[model samples]
Target chain A: MGGSEHDDGRNGKTPSAVVGDVDDFWAQALVDVPRETYVLRLYVVGNSPRSRGAIRNVRKLCDEHLAGRFDLEVHDLNQEPWLARDAQIVAAPTLVRERPLPVQRIIGSLSDIERVLVGLGVSPNPAVDP
Target chain B: MDTYESKTPVGETITKSTNVLQKVPTGIKGFDEITVGGLPRGRTTLVCGSAGAGKTLFALEFLVRGATEHGEPGVFIAFEETAVELTQSVASLGFDLDGLVASKKLAIDYVHVERSEILETGDYDLNGLFVRLEYAIASVGAKRVVIDSLETLFSALGNEGILRSEFRRLFRWLKDRGVTAIITGERGDGTLTRHGIEEYVSDCVILLEQRVHERFATRYLRVVKYRGTMHGTNEYPFLIHAGGISVVPVTSLGLTHIASDERMSTGVPRLDAMLGGKGIFRGSSVLISGTPGTGKSSLAAHAVQSACRRGERCLYFAFEESQGQFVRNMRSIGVDLKPWLDQGRLQFHASRPTLFGLEMHLANIHRLVEAFDPSVVVIDPVTNFEMVATNAEVRAMLMRLVDFLKSRGITAVFTSLTAGSGALEETDVGISSLMDTWLLVQFLEGSGERNRGLYVLKSRGMSHSNQVREFHLGSHGIDLLDVYVGPAGVLTGSARQTQEAKERADAIARQQEMDRKQRDLARKRAQIEAQILALRAEFEAEEQEVMAILEQDKRRELVLGRDREQMARLRQADPNKQQNGGGAG
Candidate 1:
């Protein structure tokens, strides 16, 4: 609940803005919107293994650390390369944490779970790890 | 991609792989002439300069000129200035950027890069900039590109490795795409570009310098390197004005200008006579070096007036006097320059030598000469440039001016004021050799009077007089009086008058003495004739008396011989015959 996106019908409300208010049941899987949810964007280059691996690793790390309290949107830079200019994105498989103020970005396969969690300001779930 | 024509040789592909790099004319005034043709085509040229050295303006003018004149579309990638600021900055130069943009001939892309907004991820390759550039170029079909001040990129990116690789990539991309590019850079410490961009761009490098001396600001340009073409190596002065940046090249090609056989008057009849009755050559350069108040400016003014009278345009560059003061001063010397000015046949450009550097002044003269298309150009008192430039620099600038004017078949006259009394054989700055004709005006002081003396130092390819003529500024105009070379060597003013009067009196006294001697000889001849006549009359009277006395004696002897005559009559007849025969024998 950092800064809400204002849509004047030019573009539909982004998926991150649909926190727990949608007719789709999957959108309601998180029954209640967390007071502070993580907003993450994963930049990839189509269906390559490296992109799939980065996406899987980042999603696995996010689910274990902050399940039902995170919003993730993956973008294929090959299709939406113009979006890179906003963050001066240069490499593929870049993960950008856009919301919750003071955006942060990292470029890798996101294979190191602990580093990714630390970079995204998230802590692992102690009960799930035990 | 085919920026160059197919005529390029096969062996030249090493420089540019896709297209043969040709020269692209910048269309900047006096710039193309110096570069012999233009900048390297389809290649990035690095222009590095200090602050306020006209790097931005140079890049902007390159784009504008390409878009407007060469009919080539251009893209301006301004890193520091926005499109609105760029538009407003060049508005005074009469470049309608908005109109060009509306016509789709020019595209201005302002790339705002802030350190806070840009987050660096690993392995960045500036692909974002490339995409934007490609889009902009493809949108306008631009053939020319300008990335003004590439140093901003290094500062913004804050990574040398990325910047270097990106610079190389950008240059190669432009070359591959066959778009001529100009990349501006800030001057570095001990390097051509601030961030060492020179190491990346290898085709051409231009360096600009701005210096302040004696409270005068001057801008100079030099080509540090041009890979395939010959360029001027001297530091040339440039000017930034309403049009654009203009560099004045201080040298030209070999001596290939056609020497005209035509002649032009020096505006003074006697002066023309001294120049073998042909005055100066039509396209020759003349130098008039003299002391102050020696009619140097007047001589130049006369030449300009005569040229204007012939209906040929004339441009006068006055370094010491303003245009109004020059016109008024010429009027006082009986030279009516206002008429020619009003008629548009003559132009006067006056500025202090301290206003700019020597080369800048030369460039200004070159600009005016080219614009006015004048047949004759006069620079009054060229020595004033000594205040702004060294003697060597002045000479170099003058040599360029002379060569340029000579190539165009334009007559040039320069006046140099030699100070002090020791201006014997010194042409200030030793530029006398460049002049096709030199007139040395000097001061002749004698009999408590100062007069102007003019003599032809040299007139190449023509027979000029060796006599020194006295320069006279009269109410009717300039008149040169023949100098009197007497026992005093050369005399002028009252000394010449006194010497001439003495000579005339000596000639008249000589004639009177000869007339007196001839009259005395005639009197002596008449007296001798009277004496001879008297002697002849006296001798005649004496002879008559002697004859009468002899006759009386003969009658007395006859009476005495009468008694014996009867006896001697018979013998007398025979004796008389014998005596007559003896007397005849």
Candidate 2:
């Protein structure tokens, strides 16, 4: 896993670099190994403590396990409140895994990494499994 | 966030206003009147009901009516259905939800919670819902909010403790925002709501019930609790129709209507004569009770025609017959109602008695009376309601109807069909006490024939004739004739005619005998006068002979005196003696 590029993606500051690196990594990895990209969206209310905690925890979990194989988007419901109704977000700090065939939703701050990985259909022991 | 932290606590706010409770008018028909005003202002009212009990519609109507009628914008947060589905469902009720939303007067947020796709990881809060609600309310500046079936959240969410505390916070937040809100819940076993939502939103609670009695369903609304105001506690029957939910708060109607002294004719002149000289009083309820085929409807039709002829509008509700059939039947009695119908002065609303429950019928009558504003109304055969409702329910419904009509000063005529076995004075519906005037028509079974006899049983505030007139439904109209009361009691039908004919013949015979006696007395008087003339003639002749005899005696006496004078002169010696003797003779 490329740790620097994953850090840039988690910071959400260098989106172009993360995309370029992910493309390059995909081109090389496709020849050597087969991997599926994970699509995830995190719904939060403003910049509250819980919202920040959930965002940081989800980014750290994604970078440590599925570095170049995941795409995460943070949605602020305060800015776009109608999306909460659209996504059926009853609780704040809700994480939805939209891809991987069947959609799954988990509500809370994502403080437990094991539960987050299992909820997102990501293998905790990704190196040994793949 | 600091925004949620700075809100005032719910308990402190409620305690501050414990002396006076302000109400927000829902603008639902008859609902506000029952609640005395409406739900507590800036508070949440729990509406709980069973399945298919019109809970969503009730809440939606509250929001719609508030938005449209009270100029108050509303936010409808639906948990069970989407906005499009709700809008389409309420279209039949004449609610333009789409138009309202387009005009920015209403905002609908469909909060769909599916339990199967959700997995609870750890602690969570419902701040997302709060954000959505706040956004919707602010967008429309809504003063009224409806959360249709808040119990849906209990099914979707796993943790009860978090959901309960979050709901409490949400209710407090809504109150602090100064918006009146309604939260609907599915009824629970032995509880007001399945999830005990009532335990939080306790300012006001309304329970809606759809009871099936005798295979007919009736919706009732009861205000289970109102915090600080006096509200009607009875289960008021409500109807969901094209207009919307209308709660009939019948007991709230006060007897403060003014009585009118004006009189209107009953179309039948003789019937009018029977009911005071000028027919029934204006704004009075007249009951025409009779057995089947005894012309109860005909008598009511007469009043309707009479009202229409006076250029006053009339509404006739025929419970048993259709409009065409009723018109045709009335035409046979010479009471043509087609012209009145054509002219739009008389409106006919025909339906079966079993078409709806008693309250529905009453609500419909109220609606029609309001729309038509007719001066006269007729409910033909109110007894037909017995087939649909109990006698007490029918009576209560009729009492409300009568009170409504009386308050509006509309002359109402109700026909009641009495069973042949029951007393003629008693009606099956038992609504006669509410009537101002009662006309009883009975079948006079006599002389091997059945005759229709009509009598004024009671007419309040008027001097009416108590005579039971034998009325015939002729080609022209109803004709009231003097019933013959001979030695054989009250005679009617052919027996009356036969008695009348016999009296006429006896009168002729007695008149002829009187004429013969008069002629005989005249003949005897003439004979007595002739005999008197004969006696006067005989007396006159006899008197003349007597007078002639007396004259002869006088002349003889003169002759005798002259002879005596002559003889005395011849004797010459005693002239003086002879003169003396002649003088003596």
lDDT of each: 0.79, 0.87
Model 1, residue pairs in steric clash: none
Supply candidate 1's per-residue lDDT for B339.
Answer: 91
Model 1 stretches astray by more than 4 angstroms: A1-130, B1-21, B427-429, B526-585
> What's the chain B TM-score of candidate 2?
0.93
TM-score of chain A of each: 0.69, 0.69
Interface RMSD of each: 6.9, 1.5
Distance from true position, residue B285, model 1, in Å? 0.9
DockQ for each of the predicted structures, in order? 0.14, 0.56
Clashing pairs in 2: none
- lDDT, model 1, position B566: 57
Candidate 1 has an lDDT of: 0.79
Model 2 per-residue lDDT tens digits across residues B1-585: 624542775468867765788999987899999999998999899999999888899999999998899899999999999999999999999999999999999999999788887877777889888888988998899999999878898999899999999998888888888899999999999999998999987789999999987777889999999987899999989999999999998877868889998999998888888787899999999999989999999999999898898999999999999999999999998999999999999999999979888878898999999999999999998888888877887888888899899989999899998889767775543788999999988999898999999989889999999898998999898999899997789999899999999999999999999999999999999999999999999999999999999999999999998887787777788667665665333
TM-score for each model: 0.80, 0.90
